[model samples]
Target: MTYLASPSTLFGRLINRTQYADLPWSNILAINFLRGRLNRLSANLPNLIEELSDENLQSAWKVLQPLYYDLYMLRAIQESKQIVQPGETLTREEALRLLHFP
Candidate 1:
């Protein structure tokens, strides 16, 4: 007998659709860092959509991990009283707090 995987699990569909090459190198590194951390935490962890729905996992990611600037950019843009450049750099501690993981 032969079996076929579900459409969701199809080999071609597993290719990452995001154009990582179009992102800045810093953003790419940040994404890779988060992916590595999550994989190290659980080899069989579900895809991002499912994982994000788990409150405990979300809390763990928020409170127990280092922050990445890419993840903090949105809020900084929304709340900042001054215009900040996308390429601006913050001190490590400041960046961590801005990302809300410090």
Candidate 2:
């Protein structure tokens, strides 16, 4: 049987193998790729949802949400770090809304 680690574990392993200085750009590239994939999926979602039973859709969402949330947080943090000016900082409400901080 194959055992899979959590998404964060897998992501950490990938990053640790790369040069730290390359992380910001590499992460941005990954984010863009994921965004494109998500956009394509979203465009198809209505048809897909029409065919899916509610139980099946819920099951798929349960599996997908964590991976998507992790990638989102990674993108947010990376972009926040890359912000160069005080004016570029996210507003308190915007940061809260985007990051879903507790």
Candidate maximizing TM-score: 2
Candidate 2 regions exceeding 4 Å error are 1-42, 84-102
lDDT for 47 in candidate 1 is 51
Leading candidate by lDDT: 2
Q: Write the residue-wise lDDT of candidate 2 on 7-50 in tens digits.
A: 33434433332456656876867865666665566567678777
Candidate 1 TM-score over all chains jointly: 0.25
lDDT of 1 by residue, 61-97 (tens): 6764444444356446555637666667688888889
Least accurate 10 contiguous residues by lDDT in model 2: 1-10
Residue 20 CA error for candidate 2 (Å)?
Answer: 20
Candidate 1 displacement at residue 50 in angstroms: 21
Q: What is the lDDT of residue 50 in candidate 2?
A: 77
